[model samples]
Target: MSTTTLTPKITMAQAINTALRDAMTADDRVVVFGEDVGPLGGVFRVTDGLTASFGEDRCFDTPLAESGIVGMAIGMAMNGMRPVIEMQFDAFAFPAFEQIVSHVAKMANRTRGKVRLPMVIRVPYAGGVGGVEHHCDSSEAYYAHTPGLLVVTPATNADAYGLLRAAIDSPDPVIFLEPKKQYFSKEEVDVTAPVPPIGRAVVRREGRDATLITYGPSVPVALAAAEQAAAEGRDVGVVDVRSIVPFDDETVCAAVRATGRAVVVAEAPGFASVASEIAARVTERCFHHLEAPVRRVTGFDIPFPAPKLERHQLPGVDRILDAVDDLQWEES
Candidate 1:
């Protein structure tokens, strides 16, 4: 469905806020908690004034510990409370790893599918915000490796609302990663609309020559690169794998089969990254359609550096276009 044409005053962040407010109003069982979520209104103000609006009983703040934040949410979920826990930053999620991996991820299966945890862990992720080392990270692979947890990322404001709505409303646990940089970026979204199913990828743009596959934060960059490639008379396909964990292999393989060439893009480090996984699977599934070795233009292998050096490290449209140029396809 397309975004409804309304006054363009709302931003992507506002769309998220709208969804959270709606959810709390719709379901009394839905409780919001996190560090500074009430008085300070969260670091980015995503949860601004929510406590006052919804009352402290449902919307409240927690201690500084992530383990405490998540572990308590697990108990609340088991006891039949839908807790929406927010991680202050992307990298801050590591400390809560034990509770998530040990309890939250295995509870339903450990109970022989009789019990489940209906909790949503919201994390603001990725760089481009000039954050310190442990703040901006595309840690999708970490949670994706853990089974029984639904992992998702939104590239657009509309998907942000739909996916978060579906996530909170679902019966399973969901790890929702939001690109910190895109938090303030404006996008058209109709909050009155219904959302699509979770764990499905959307083909953002169509191309015949090559595919530029990507997801959160980097999707807009891929679209910009595709525009430049089009100006040079090259067809570039851009696919948004909105659902990262339950990756949409059918759509991805279909695009690669048609294009015969693929280049994966992401803000994460180059080594052992999501780009690597996608290239491997695409090569395996679309071997016959291959024209040249699939490539990836991603962040440098080194740690995410200071703001000035980060530009050189992060993959830009020029680099993606360069990957497209470097390929020497035989049949295409």
Candidate 2:
């Protein structure tokens, strides 16, 4: 919650690593458990050094069973422990969905204020890594649609660090999704930086021509396209919707109204995707302000493509610029 700028030298994955380390150090009750998280440091190495620093009890690896991972986490939370469970990939999270829905999500209310579940479930989702169907899946909607689940995603290292910390400390269960493809993407992350609170959107860029709304992996592409749009004499505003469950409609509505056009982007499939909800809600509230229809620039409805053609499959700078080109706007 403090804001002092440190040199930006960490990757998004590294920021997440530091965040988890800080959280564990701050709270003795905080326990990080996942498959291969101990000696293995997780499949993505986000938990690389925890076991050495905090010992095996605080940060340890778990069995391969998803249900067991989730069930054990819930038990630990009920007994006054803060558990952060990491699902290796989006696809592997499905096996634990039942446990999440039946127990972890409802433990607090179901017990009538007698028990609280303070746990964060982190899963790496969305297409673009040329991963298999499950590995690259964007299952935010699935969790968001479930009652009592707080779903939040970060498109940058800063948001990833702060938001994950918030999720870990919250009383309710949180579904924390990371864009695996963005793991290596570098950005200026000051370890001593102040992060915006939960359920907020960050306006990455300002413009008057059109609004590009996205989160997670597509945020960088949208920003790149906004820059390219400037060369074509177009003004584009980019809003990174960091929190998904309790969405930040104010920022998105304001940006779209000012621009009179909007393009919602994501790597998830177009049909019933989270991007669709953003487009639909914006179009509804900003109908009078919109000049052209609010269109979506998202991944194809098919499964994730091979690495060779992933750039074509997922939304990119060119694709975002093309959508911007289609929007109606006044030029000098």
Candidate 3:
């Protein structure tokens, strides 16, 4: 069915909440549970009003145990229920790492197709909220590394609604990482509109000089840099890779090849990150089309810094433009 409904402007968090309410209303088997998800509506209030609307069975709270939350969700999925479990914070999810990596991720394959774990694990991630240690880690690479998980992160309000809906309905387990930084960022979104497929990347802007490949929270930064580049007479394109696990290489490589230069950006540290994988793939596929080596604008290789120090650690407009500036000096 077409998910086409015109709606007023809204924030990413609001779009997500709409998706959850819709999912619960559409399917009785669908359920949501996490710490404070019922009463507090989650730390960000993304699940706010769900309990009042869907009642305790559909929208409820779990113990403060991450592992138990995931493990129980896995069991529920196997028993013919679709469970959407939330991990309150990014770092807080690590406590359930064993269940995720060992069980939830491999359940389908482990049962040799006899079982399907249709579950969604939601995590609020990344810095910019002035959050403490466990609150702002970009742990996407860890889930992307797992074999059986479908990892997705949405940058805009529309994608947030569409992708969250898609994730809840997916036959496999999904790690839906919500960029905390972009939660309050607003846009006009139609919750009923047809959403793009889960893994396809979208080119937010077009250009001829260079392409800025980014996803999640860093998408806005890349787009801002592109605008700045345009003012300086440089045509810089921007691609939002909405999904991390499937990693849209075709769209990204095509954009880079057309521009002949590319910069991959991510808030995660540079060492072995999603940005690194993007750089490698673009280089391999668009090797002959490239005029310069692929560059990455990412967080530092150290731990997530203190709140006040994040501005310097995270990639910004200047950092992205600097990478683009480097591309100009390279020979064709």
Best by lDDT: 3
| Model 2 stretches with alpha carbons more than 4 Å out | 1-4, 330-332
Point out the higher-scoring one by TM-score: 2 or 3: 3
Pull out the clashing pairs in model 1: none
| CA lDDT of every candidate | 0.88, 0.86, 0.91
lDDT tens per residue, model 1, 145-230: 79988888999998888898988998999999998888898867777676767878888999999999999989999999999999
Candidate 3 per-residue lDDT over residues 229-300, each given as its tens digit: 999999999999999878888898889889889999999999998888889989889999988889999999
Q: Candidate 3 regions off by >4 Å?
A: 1-5, 328-332
Model 1: worst 10 consecutive residues (lDDT sum): 1-10
Clashing pairs in 3: 3-192, 3-193, 4-192, 5-192
The count of residue-pair clashes in candidate 3 stands at 4
My TM-score estimates for the predictions, one after another, are 0.96, 0.94, 0.97
* Model 1: per-residue Cα lDDT at residue 28: 91
lDDT of 3: 0.91
What residue runs in model 1 are displaced by over 4 Å at the alpha carbon? 1-7
Residue 122 in model 1: shift from native, Å?
A: 0.7
